[model samples]
Target: MVWKLPLHESGHPENELTAESDGAVIRRTVLPGGVRVVSEQLPGQRSASIGAWVNVGSRDEQSGHFGSTHFLEHLLFKGTKRRSAMDIAEAFDAVGGEANAVTGKENTCYYARVLDTDLPMAVDVISDMITSATIDPAELETERGVILEELAMNDDDPGDVVHEQFSAAVLKGHDLGRPIGGTPDTINAVPREAVWEHYQEHYQPETLVFTAAGNIDHDVLCADISQALKVGGWDLTPGVAPRARRDTTPIVGLGQESVEMTIHRSVEQANVIIGSTGITATDDRRFQLSVLTAILGGGMSSRMFQEIRERRGLAYSTYCFGSSHVGTGTFGLYAGCTPARIDEVTELMVGELEKMADSGITPAELERTIGQLSGSLVLGLEDSGSRMNRLGRAELVTGELYSVDESLKRIREVTAQEVQVLAQELASRPRSIVRVGPFGS
Candidate 1:
């Protein structure tokens, strides 16, 4: 996965993807294991972000092994042989930087942000942390207590619970159905040996991607990644997983799904979420969905805010969001409204979606949607964390990288017909509804 100078863009970059760094050179490096590295270096920005991305996530876990990835995330934060967790936290904080990681449907990311001058320091710690950190017995026990509290907190909050539960329902029989934070029953059941076993199999650097953005020299970064690969190799086997089947999936209306999330501490406001699975991470149509989401619920001028709140005062919050992954994704709508107005509000929201289904958006709406999405993409890329994410995720999902221009182009070229198609497909999914709050009748 090494590239020579003047490396040409691989796939056609999206036309509207104007978010690239002018000074940046996109490159790839193949390390010892099959790890692939991709990046864009922006010399003008003062900061750099480096991250280790593993394609394995909670969705890849075996039954009874739920939340193992997230649990593993906690264990990583505990002291390693070289540094105590406190020491690690302090080291980053002392430098005016932040270090963090998260587990998702198809990937787990460990990232660090720092001054461009400290780029080597950034890579050194992340490389060592991901490749050689020891999972000591004492630290494991202490971390379990921390993770249990985290799980309890999730259980006690309906807003969170409904999303987790809804995920379970949508990805049923699939590893993705399980919560990223394991239940006490499962977590307590998993022994120390199993955690180690999972790590041994999943944490292969060959399947990993390391990325850096801002003030990075492509050659120097490639050299750093090569060194990390030499440190993390193991007896590797080729990885492959068949896509799960969803042949009989229904176009379930909101009423058909049982979604009751009640919190005892009653308040005037309640959050209602409607969502379901729609696309894969690699689907080209996702760009359209991004644009459509902005047009439908992105800001005050967006349809949901204009129609649901401004005109009727039906809710305080309203938005549409899309979550995409290597093989699957979820699209959702969320709003906080008066419990007394839930029925009216739900109907109004449904009408908006239905209107899109029947009458595709006008040309002006489509253009505005693309503009907002393109601007948002550019703004997000200014951060090292976000840049590293974009690079790593592109490698993991498509086995290729996209330029900022490519992304913008995809968004720009999305026709009203495509948005209509996406809308129709989204509306057709088994629409699960979750409502949490008071309704005194």
Candidate 2:
């Protein structure tokens, strides 16, 4: 069983709680100014991973500000009031640690992995970056060119471009459909003021989650974070409720019709994705859907790999994936094959989908997929970085926390019938196809 620490809301300067189960101790401390710090101490681990999770992403941007979130992600690393980009780099390098950040559809995370003894420095540096970024106009202009190069790079990859088209086709007219990196035009047009305004509005103490995992003391780390933020003039007031969760329900008005889009590129290989709308992140069927996806195309032993690569040698790569957001999701089967074989590949992929929907997976497939899913889940959490990510995402995104054992048990409890039901439900949805290849092939 997973035990969650009881939270204290008594307006204390540093209200703390701890929960222990399965040999893992999870701790939480509500600091002044409504900052929430959560940590998990892993025994005998020499490294610590920490992340400052901000509850904003591309989906939160308005129409004209398409790439503001991602652009800001880059700008934050450019310089802070206390440290230049070079200083920040040297700080991490001195500790033999790595620092990075990522912007997703719904959140942005700035994280670092460092020796356990350097946990304090990691917290200080990351907190400083978040709370004190200069967002200099000169820096913004430089980063703008960098981001345009990034967009150009994406344009050069047919596989990446096809997935973008697939998203636009299926989730048309919604912010979720737009690329996380704004288009070149939008990126160029967005004024520096707009991004700064976004940063100010979203980067609040209450909207951030600070999480660390490894051999560390939660109380000391919390104090370090508080001190760091205080250096940037953050008001550490206690007793305020954290910001309410953002509503992530995308505006969906496109009719549920099968949409097919083709992007004519000069690439030698055709990249294709056959996909459909899927359940939300909060849906109960997600576990079963995961199992279903695994059996269909998760590994060399998966059905798609065996049928497409092993038997026919039609493609070197083929797989199925499911992506869930706060209120919407997608399931897709992707293949990269010679343009000459695009039609055959699509036919076979779609046929497999129809078969799974109608007949369901066999008992052996179900057991094997469950085992694969279980093993993958266990193996993924073996490091402090993974554990830190799990903690931050759970606190910021899902709002539900579970221990490793608890998560594995849930995956193990998925029944064959449940997977079959989910498979049929997902397969029955109208599929949208996007292909990128030479025009006449």
Top TM-score prediction, candidate number:
2
Put down candidate 2 lDDT per residue, 1-441, tens digits, no spaces.
544433344255334657774576888877777778889998888999999999898889986677899998999889998899899999999989999999998899999999999988989889998899999999999999999999999999998998888888887777778899989999999998899989999898877789888898887998899999999778777776566665556536542888999889998899999988887776777788888888888899988989999999999999998888887888899999999999899989888877888888898998888889888888888888888888877776666678777788899899887887888888888989999999653
Global fold similarity of model 1 (TM-score): 0.85
Q: What is the C-alpha lDDT of each candidate?
A: 0.69, 0.85
Model 1 segments more than 4 A misplaced: 1-21, 228-268, 439-441
- Per-candidate clashes come to 11, 2
Question: RMSD in angstroms, candidate 2?
Answer: 2.1
**lDDT tens readout by residue for model 1, 134-221:** 7777888888888889888877676776577666655555665677777888887877777877777787655566777777876787
> Could you tell me which residue pairs clash in candidate 2?
33-236, 33-237
Q: Which parts of model 2 have CA positions greater than 4 angstroms off?
A: 2-17, 248-255
Whose lDDT is greatest here? 2
TM-score for each candidate, following the candidate numbering: 0.85, 0.95
